[model samples]
Target chain A: MRRGIGFWTGLGFTLLISAFLILPVLASVIAGVTANQFVGLSSGLTTRWLVEVWANYGGTVLLSLRIALATLAVTLLIGIPAAYVLARHAGVTARLVEEALVMPVAVPGIATALGLILAYGAVGDLRASWLFILAGHVVFCLPFMLRSVLAVLLALDLKGLEEAARACGASWPQRFLGVVLPNVSGGVLAGSLMVVTLSLGEFNMTLLLHTPFTRTLPVGLADAYTALRTEMASAYTLIFFVLIVPLLSAMQWAASRAERLGR
Target chain B: MSVAIRLAGCGRTWPGGSIALHPLDLDIAAGETLVLLGPSGCGKTTLLRLIAGLEAPDAGGRVFFDGEDVTRLPIERRHVGMVFQSYALFPNMDVAGNIGYGLRVRGVARAAARRRVDEMLAMMRLDGLGGRRIEALSGGQRQRVALARAIAPRPRVLLLDEPLSALDARLREQLRQEIDALLRSLGITAVYVTHDQAEAMALGDRIAAMEKGRIAQIGTGRDLYHRPANDFVAGFVGDTNRLATPEGERLVRPEHLALRRSATGGFTVVQATFLGPVVRVLLRDAAGRELRADVPDEDVPAPGERVAVLFQGRSLETEAAASPA
Candidate 1:
């Protein structure tokens, strides 16, 4: 297709905005590799800050991974079947239930976290555990998973497919496992990525919910930023990027591949 | 092994207290294709669903397969095959995977399932296309895959819910003929549903013309054309025009009505549509009683021309026309 001058102008403007957004992150990555942030790269590159960040905050990184996976598992377990059920009914009741599920996402994260603490804070074991923060993450992440899968289920010819499966003599388990899951794989993948991403990066709710012992990566990064040096904080950011980028890249590739495969 | 199906007072009612199909008894003979014919919302599909075990009949109702009571059996236990108009082929699976899904779920061994899938592909003229994805195939091919998948399980009864309605006119006709042959060759008791009267006529051994929530009439195409039990069946199964005969008003077809240009005739040609083999002419008399006649294109009178109408060939008095007066 031929493009007019307007397209070139738009491309230039977009590039300018991208550079503005990306230049800071690039500078941080460079600072992380430098021996000293004040002297910049001429001070000579070294892995000491990166190593220091890993040693000081490695447990938090591991805890964050655990939280993300736990949150994802909970969402998938409840969300997929919930989506199917809600998709099938599609009445006012179902809509009401969906909106209710999404209420946590719509409200302030800290408010939701405060509600959780008020309800469960009486139990000392529950309040101090990473599971408390995990609960907050699940509440925030589940709606994304449910809505993603629900949208796909609603868009599909789910009734026809179910009827066809039943008429083919397939048991309920067989139909769900073989037919429903494979057809909705794209949605499930997208939802999983969103759940994990949100759980990992979630700050405000996690901030209020987490105890010092249950510190997640983002909380640790904030601590490092406030109390530590620029080089160390920049190295912590680099570690965060290292932990998240490959996962994001893998999910993006999988989604594109699934798109190429027909629904 | 096809089995006779019987629905004894089988009916469906929604949770909202709306009746989709009123309690009615129906018997379908083994190896016969009984089509449920009606316009949408006439409960034809509801009846088919009742037979397929997808919908249970209301209280005091029962379904029997080959004289064995199967009213309580769900569709999986009933072991029936069904094809939908949308050709609901599993998009994730290739053609062969979709066809063999039934057999695989039924516990057929991998090798045996492959052999059966191959046989079904050949039977449906889908050879070498098994590796193709469902989305890769054209509409007709997808429908053929749907048919192959349904029949692969060797179901005792096959249910097709307007399977060919999604295709273009030419493809629909071609596939219709192929399906007719397939049903005949399989000899499995099948209940087909469609709103198209012509399709119902072409494929049904017996057509059940439904109206509202009940079967208005059930007979062969010829029987329906000649002897509709009521006005609904008469109008639905085929075009039937009212004729004011000497004895009383009677139903007639456009082909049976003869139109001739007459200077003194009270009927005026309202419109003449040339439809290739025949020209459909609409005429209205002084009383505004409209009559339609199909004639050769050469005999078409211009619009507003006066014409006389006469019933020929076989009128209401014909031996086959035994419908109640």
Candidate 2:
């Protein structure tokens, strides 16, 4: 088929915007492997900067992974049931509660972290432990998990399915485990990916909440950029993308699979 | 095994005081198939849910299963099988998994559950399709899976709520016959709910015709057709024409009314519609009251012809007197 001028113009515009968005990330990736970012590609590529980054920030990376996984676990435990209740009630009260839960996401992360610190900082143990950082991550990541699960629940005939299960002699736990959980697997997958990725890269909130010993990857990345060589910071950025891209792709696959099953 | 059911003053009211079902008494003998037939929002589904233990009746109401009071029993303990209009099959499970879900939940062994699921698969004529996902099945096939799943656990009573309303007309008729045969072979007490009158007449051993949250009448198809207790049942069960008789207002079936051509008659034929088996002749009397008569195709009067209308049946008593007219 022959293309029209409008189609070509739109294509050009989209490509231009994509390049505009991706060019900096591409430069950072190239700089991560380059011998010296100041001299650009002519300086040649090497893995020394990546090795240096691992040697210096490996603890921060592991801490971020631990915090992200813990955040994922905490949010799933609390967010799923909260979403289920909200979806079932679905009245004025549910709307109010949902709005309140989403308030942290709507507010600036720094302000939310400040509020959390003020509320719990009086307790010396909580203020010093990595769990203090985990608490902030849970609050920040919960809305994503809840919203994803709630979307799936709202789309489903949950009451009808539950009644059918009940009529089949299944107990409440059986229905939840057998029917509700499996039906919402795609939503859970999508939410888990978002929570993990966001929690791993979260800087503003983590910076406010973290003790020196509890420094996360993004906080460490910021510190590396300010206090270390440019190539090392770029290597850290490259590492972050490497860790998150596969998870994002898995989420995409789950979304498409969900759409197919829905059809 | 089949079980008799009794609803003593069972009714339902929503949280805001809106009545969904008025308090009413009902009884179903073992192995009887009772159809609760009504239009949308007429409380037929609500009554069925009460019997299935999915809904609690209002205060002072009670439900019984085989002489045992189960009013407070939840659906999980009631052990009644239910089929919904949407088929409500678990999307995550294949046909065999869905059919065996109830048995599995009841602590049946995996091997036994598989055997029963296979038996149900064959019974529903879905022998080789047990491994197929729900999305892969046709509408009729999905309904079959749903039915198979509902009945696999051998519940005491079976409840179906507009189970065939979602299928196409040809499929609906075929499945309706299959359901009738299944109900008879199983000999399980079944409470079916639907808005379709033809379905009610075909499958119901006794049809409870409801209107505005109350049962207008309950009887066999013949009784409801020939001797409706009220005008609501009369008009709802079948097509009827209300005639202004000197004895008082009378309801007559269209088939029972005879139309004959005559000059200077009180009735004029306004429209003649040919409907293959019968020609429906519509007439307007001098009082501007419309009446319909289904006559043979060969003797159908043309439009604008004056005709004399004769009543073939006696006037039915108007006990309630407040018909939907």
Candidate 3:
């Protein structure tokens, strides 16, 4: 095919926007390795800042991973069945309930966190525990999980599939395990990735919910940027990317696979 | 082995209080193939679902399988096989896995299930396609897999709900013949539902014609066509014209009507349509009553010509309209 002016123009515009989005991350990567970010790249490159950031915030990184995994598990356990019910019922009550689940996503996460703290703050055990932050992460990440699974459920002929299973003499539990779970596994995979990504990066809720000892990666990154040098903060950002890029790539792969499957 | 089925006062009313099927009784002898024939919303599907245990009947209604009460049983416990119009094959499973699912669910050993699956694959002419994915198959192949899956477990009864309605006309005819052969070979009691009269006539040993949640009539295809109990059945079974006679309104099939040359007091030929073997002639009388007659193409009269309509066989009275004198 022959090149056209419009095609070149659109390509140039897309490249320009991509550069605009990626330049900041590239600068951070450069700064994270620089011997002295204040003196610019000509000074030298070294891993000293990265080593310092890891030594200072390694526990926070592990805590973030723990909280993200917990959030993923809890959201999936509750969201999948809730989505199933919402998909099957499809009445006013189900609609209202679905909207209520989405309320956390629509409202600012800080407000939701504040509300949770105000309601449960009286209990010292819960308020001081890492599970308190896990609760806030679950609230923030659940809507995405439910929405993903519900989208797949609503698009499928699940009721017909269930009926077919029943006619084959499968009990309810057997049908759920054998038919429903396999069919919705793609949705569950995509949703789990979303939950982990959101929970790992979540700051607005964690800012209000986290205690000094229960600090997550994002909370620690914020504290490092404010209390430490710019190079240390940039190194923390690089580490965050290292932890999250694989999950993002897996999500992309799942999305394309679902498209290929025509679901 | 096939089991006889009996429904005593079975009916269904939707949650919103709309009657989907009125209370009715029906019986199917062991190894019989009964087709429920009706247009959409005529309650044919509701009756089939009631028998399948997918829907419970209204109070005072009961369903029996081999004279055992199964009214309270759910579909999972009913032990019936069903084929749906959409073919509802598990997309996650391969053809062999889909065919073997029922047996596995019934706690059959893995090797035994594999044998049954292979047997079904051969029976349905799906050899060499057992490992193929569902999305890789054609519509006809998917339907064949659905049938293989349904019958692999050898359930006591088979319920097919418009299974061929999704296929093209040519494929529908082919699969219809295949289904008829399979039913005969299995000798399993089956309840087939369809809106196509030709399909009902071809596959059913007996057909229960339903209308507005009620059974209009039940008989063999010959009985429904030649000796319909009422006008609805007469018109529903085949092409028919109602003619006013001294006795009353009489129903005559287009095949039975013969066109004759006449001057007046008969029908004037309005149009002639040649359809391969026979030409259908449309006629109108002075009373403005219209009738269609299928005559030999060689003897077709041109439009605006006058012809008398002759009844070749016995004309039926519209019992729905009035008593036959």
**Interface RMSD of every candidate?**
2.3, 3.3, 3.5
Q: Provide the lDDT at A7 for model 1.
A: 100
**How close is every model to the real structure, measured as TM-score?**
0.95, 0.95, 0.96
Model 3 residue A95 lDDT? Answer: 93
Tens-digit lDDT track for model 2 on A1-263?
99999999999999999999999999999999999778889999999988999998988888998999899999999989999899899689899999999999999999999998899988879998889999999999999999999999989999989988998999999999889888888788889888998999899999999888988999989998898678899999998888778767876787678756543
Top model by TM-score, which number?
A: 3
User: Which candidate should be chosen as best, given DockQ against the real structure?
Assistant: 1
A174-203, model 1: which lDDT tens digit per residue?
A: 999888988888799889989989999999
Cα lDDT tens digits, model 2, B1-325, are 7999999998899999999999999999999999999899999999999998888999999999999999999999999899998888998888898999999999999899989999999999999998899999999999999999999999999999999999999999999999999999999999999999999999999999999899999999888888888878888888888777775577888988888789977899999999999988889988799999999888678999999998876555556443534
Residue-by-residue lDDT tens digits, candidate 3, A22-130: 9999999888889987799998999998899999999999999999989988998999999998999979999999999999998998999999999997787998899
Instruction: Compute the DockQ of candidate 3.
Output: 0.57
Q: By descending DockQ, how would the candidates be arranged?
A: 1, 2, 3
**Candidate 1 vs candidate 3, lDDT winner:** 3
DockQ for all candidate structures vs. native: 0.67, 0.58, 0.57
User: Which runs in model 2 stand beyond 4 Å of their true positions?
Assistant: A246-263, B317-325
What's the C-alpha lDDT at position A22 in model 3? Answer: 100
Better of 1 and 2 by TM-score: 1
